[model samples]
Target: MRNQILGRQGEQVAVEFLQRQGYGICARNFRVPVGEIDIIARKGDVLAFVEVKTRHGNRYGTPAQAVNFHKQKKIIQTAQWFLRQKCLSEDKCFCRFDVVEVYALPEGKWQVHHLPGAFEC
Candidate 1:
């Protein structure tokens, strides 16, 4: 329960950060039969499928480190489905996989890192 709250808080922070960076948010918590995507945003002509990982501290690892190869594959699969559902071709509006790392610090503060074009499908 605590982790979920922390994750939610982190995701909120990520959204604000992305908005400040000029990314137009399209969706949050997009879910399909296979899995879920944390956020879908567009920056210019690029559609970004983002995975948000939030952690309390760096004791475990950087939040982005959690996006392993298997996770990347799942995200790619979901992104493909998203494009198909929207009837948009990746060739027309380029697709990108991004990672948003949120570090939940004490006193309700957070440190965020955005990794655009983190991987290709």
Candidate 2:
């Protein structure tokens, strides 16, 4: 339960960071039958589906490293479902996947890094 709270808090921070960077937030925690998208935003004509990973330290690995090929496939499937449900044509708008890494610091603040167009579907 504590971890869930921290995760949600981290996601909120990611959303705010994206907004500040001129990305229009389209959705948060967008759920489909396949999986959930942490944050969805638009920059110009491109729709960005972002996966946010937060960790206390790099003892295991970097946050972005957690998103492996299998995970990327799941995200892409979910994004497809989202677009279909919204009646949006894939060709009408550009789509890209992004990953946001958040590190929880000792001072109780977070360091956010946004990797735009991080991966391809």
TM-score of each: 0.96, 0.96
Q: What is the TM-score of candidate 1?
A: 0.96
Looking at candidate 1, what is the lDDT of residue 78?
86
> What RMSD does model 1 have?
0.8
Candidate 1 per-residue lDDT, tens place, 33-112, comes to: 77789999998998899999999877888888899999999898888888889999878998899999998778878899
lDDT of each: 0.90, 0.92
* Best candidate according to lDDT: 2
Say which candidate scores most in TM-score: 1
Off by over 4 Å in 1: none
Total backbone collisions, model 2: 0
